[model samples]
Target: MTTRTMLQRPAFHWLAAAWPYALIGLVTLLVRSPTFGNPILDFDEQLYLLVGDRMLHGHLPYVDLWDRKPVGLFALYAAIRLLGGSGIIQYQLIATACVVIAAWFVRAIVRRHMGEIPAIVAAVAYVLMLNVLHGLGGQTAIFYNALTAFAAWCACKANDANTPGRIAALALAAMLALGLAIQIKYTVIPEGIFFGCWFVWRLFAAGERLRRLLGIAIAMVLVALAPTGLALGAYALAGHLDAFLFANFTSIFLRQPFPTQVRNDQISQVVACCMALLTTAGVGLFQLRTHAHGRVYADFPLLAGWWVSAFAGFGMLGDFYDFYFLPVVLPSVILGAFALRGERRGFTFGCLLLLWPCIFIPANYFSRHQGILQTSRMVSAISPYVSGHCLYIYDGPTILYYLTNACIPTRFAFPDHLTNPIETRALGVDPVEEERRVLASQPGAIVTASRSVVPRVAPATQALVREALVRDYVLIARTPTIDRTYYIWARRDLHPGPAPLVDPRAANPQ
Candidate 1:
C-alpha cells in the first residue's frame, strides 16, 4: 500500500513506461481528427490526390500528371489513395504515424545523452511543434521528417558503438534512410550532405584507418545511391526517364525567382520562425562551443549541421509556408533537449515554451468549423455535365476532379503553369501548347471562376482557356459564390441550354 511498494510493482513500472506513448497518440488523434475526413482543399493535398488517382490507373507521374515533386511523393499519395480510396482519413492516419515515429526518435536520441525526463519533454515538444503552424496537414515533411530523425538516431548509434561492424551497419542504415528522405523531398538533400560530413567526422574521430574508412565510404556511397538509382531505373523501364529527370532534378533550379515583395514577406516569416525556434539554435550553438572537449559533444556538430543545412535548403526559395518548416524542427528539438541537460525543472519550463504555438496559434490560424460539405452545392451544379465526360477546370478547385470523377484532359491540373512565369519556366512545360492540346480534346464540360476568387488561375492562363471556351462552347449555368462566380460551359454541339459561354464577363456587363 506504500508508495515505495507500489513503485516496485511490475504493473506500475509497465504503466509508467507506456503512458507517454499512449498520451502522445491520444493527443495526436484529438488535434488531427476533426479535419481527417474533410474534403481536400485546393492546396497540395488535392493536387497530390489527383495525381495519385492517375497513377492508380497505371499512368506514371510527369507523363500523365505533371508536378515538380519527386516521384516518391506521388508514390506516397498513391499508397494513401490505394488504402483509403480518396478518403482523407487515410492520409491523416499516415500523418499521425509520422509524428509519433518522429517523436519516438527525438526521445530516443535525447535519452541517450540525458535523463528520461528531458527526453520525454523533448519528444512531447516535437509532437506539439508539429501541430502548430500548418504542420497539422499531411505535408511531405510530416512523413519524411520521421525518417530523417531515424537517420539521426542511426548516426548517433554509429558513433556510440565505435566498432567496425556496428559502425558500418549503422552508417549504411543512416545513409539509406537519408537517400529515401531525399527522394521524398529533394530539399532534404542538403541535410544528407551534412550527414556525410558528420559521418566522415565520426570515422576520423574514431581513428578509423585509411583502408577501413575508404572501404566504408565506398559502401556508403553505393548504399546512398541505391534508392535514387532504383527509382531512375523504374522510370526508364516505364519509358518515363526523361519526364522523371526533368521534374525531380532539373525543375528545381528552373523555378522562377520570387519577386521583391514576396521575398520580403517570406524573409519576414523566416525571421519570425528563427525567433520562434530560437531555443534550438541557441542551445545547439552553446553546446557546440562550450562542450567542444566533451565526448558527448561530438554529436552536437551533426545536429548543428543538420539544422543549418536543412533550413538553408528548404528556405532557399524563401517560401514561408507553415509546413515547410517541419523538416528543420527535428534537429531543433534534439538540440533543445541537450540544452536542457542538468538544469533543474527544465522539463516543465521547456514543455511550456515548446507548447506555446500549440496552445494559441492553431485556433486562430485554422477555421474551427469547415468541411467538404461546403462545396456540395457547387459539385451538384457541375456534376451532370462532368460525371461521365472529360472535364477541364480553368479556375476551380482541384477537388472537383475527384468529386466529379472525370478524366482530366491535360497534365496541367491547375492554372499555375499558365499564369506564373516562374512556374511555367520551372516545369519546362509550355502552357500554350498544353492549352491547345487540352482544348483540342474538347472536354464535354469546362469550369471557370470569375476573377474575384481568392485564388483564380493566372490571368493569362485564364484568358487563353476562356478564349477557346468562348469560340467553341456555350454557357449552361452560372453560380455565384461569395468569392467568385462559377461558369459551367458545354460544347456548342451539345446545345447546353441555349446560353452563350462567350465571355460572360463581356455579355453580363456587371
Candidate 2:
C-alpha cells in the first residue's frame, strides 16, 4: 500500500478528529488528577456521593434520605457508584469527563464564527474557569454543565439548519437535553426558556403560519417540561409525592438567605477573579466594531443569549456559592474568544492565561489537596469509634460519613442543614429537634471542629451539640490538619481507650 493509504485509514480519521479533544481531556486530567483519590475536597460532592452510595442500597433520595437538592443529582451520583462502587475517585473522574465534554461543546459554538484556535482557547477557558470558581471535584454543575452545553450546541445547529423538518428535529433534541438538565438542577429553567424561544423565533422568521408556529412552540414547551413532569409523576405514584415536592421545590424559597457578609465576600471574590476574563471578552466585542466581523456579528445573539441566561441562573435563588457559577463559565469564555480574532499569536495565548487569576480566590483549593493525606489519618483514628452504629459530623466535613462508611441517623444528612443558623427556618424539620434526635440515636462517632475554627454555625444548634458532647462523649483523638484541627469523639459510656492516630501518610489511597 502507498504511504497515503495509512493516513486515509478509518482509525486514522477518528484519531485526527479526536486528538484535539483528547489532548484537552488529558490536560484536564493532569490539572485535576491531584484531587483524585483525595476525597473530601468539598462538602457538596461528598454528601452527593454518600446519598448515591445509599441509593445503590435501594434507598431513595427524598423518601429515605433528605436534602433539598433535586433527585436527578443523586441519580447521577448513583450511576457513578454503580460503575466504580463506593470509591470517591469514580465521581471525581466522572465529573472531570463532564467538564471536558462541556468544553468540547464550548469549542463547537465558537467554531461556527471563529477559527479552531479561538475555539480551542474557549474550550481551555471553560476547564480552567471551573477550577477558579471551585468546580474542581464532583459538584452538580460539573454534570449539568455538560448537559446544558450540549443543549445549547443543539440550538446552534438548529440556527444553521435549512429544512423545516431538520430544524424541528434539532430543536426537539435541544429541548430534551435541557429537560434532563433541569432535573439535574432547576437553575437551567431560564436557559431552557431562552432556547425554546430561540427555536420558536426561528420558525416565525421563516414565515411559517401561525398554526404551525404555535404547534412547534407548544411542542417545545412540553418537551422542555417532560423530565420534571415525569419525576413528579413517579413520586405521586409512590405516595411520597408530597415529600418530594417539599424537598425539591417549596423548601428552597423558604430557606433563609446567607448572611450579608457571606454574600458580599462571594460577590467580591467572583468579581475579582472574573475581571481579567470579562475585560478580554469586552475588548473582543469592542474590536468587532472596527474589524467589520460580519459572520460573528450575525451569530452574536446565540452566544450572548446563552451567557445572559446561564449566568442569571446563579442569582435565581439569591444564593451565590462558588460552584453555582459553573454553568456560566463556558459562555463567558466563548465570548472572551472574540478577543482572540486579533493577529498576534502571543497576545491570544496571554488572553487564555488570564483565566488562571481566579484560582487565587478559592485560595488553596489546589494546595489543600496536599492535606488529603494528613486528613485521612483521622479516618483510622476515628473510624473504629463508629464501627457499628453511625457517624454524625455536627460541625465537620460531611465526607467523614463516607470515610467511616457508618450509618447516618437523620434524613438531613447535610451538615449545613443543621449547623448553619439561617437554615433553621428553611428545612421542614426543626433544626434543633433534628439535632437532638440525632444525639438521642447515639451515633458511634461524632466529629466537631476544634475551638479555633469558625464557619457559619447556628448558635442554638452549636450549644446543644457542645453540651451533649461534654456530657456523653469523650475526645478519643485530636487530628491535626494543614489548616486547623478536629476532634474525634466516642461515647464516654463505652469508656473508650486512646484511639491510635494513623500517621498522615499511612492510609492507602484508592
lDDT of 1 by residue, 30-122 (tens): 766655765543256777777776788887788888887778877887888878655566777887898888888888887777677777777
TM-score for each predicted model, relative to the true structure: 0.86, 0.91
Put down candidate 2 lDDT per residue, 1-510, tens digits, no spaces: 887999999999999888888878887787787777666576678888888888888888887788888788888888888886545888888888988899889888878877887787778777777777768788778888898888888777877766767778878888998888888889988898888888877777667778987888889889988988988898899898999989898888887887788888888877777776776766655554445454555456776788789878978989777678778776777777777765784266446545465445454466555557655776786677677778887756677777677888888887777877777777888988988899999887777765423346677777777777767776767765645567777777664454344333211100
Clashes of each: 1, 0
Q: How far in Å is the alpha carbon of 17 misplaced in model 2? A: 3.3
Q: Evaluated with lDDT, which candidate comes out highest?
A: 2
Question: For candidate 1, which ten residues in a row score worst on lDDT?
Answer: 362-371
Whole-model alpha-carbon lDDT for candidate 1: 0.71
Lowest summed-lDDT stretch of 10 residues in model 2? 501-510
User: What is the lDDT of every predicted structure here?
Assistant: 0.71, 0.76
Please identify model 1 stretches exceeding 4 Å from their true place.
1-6, 114-117, 287-295, 316-322, 338-352, 358-369, 449-459, 468-510
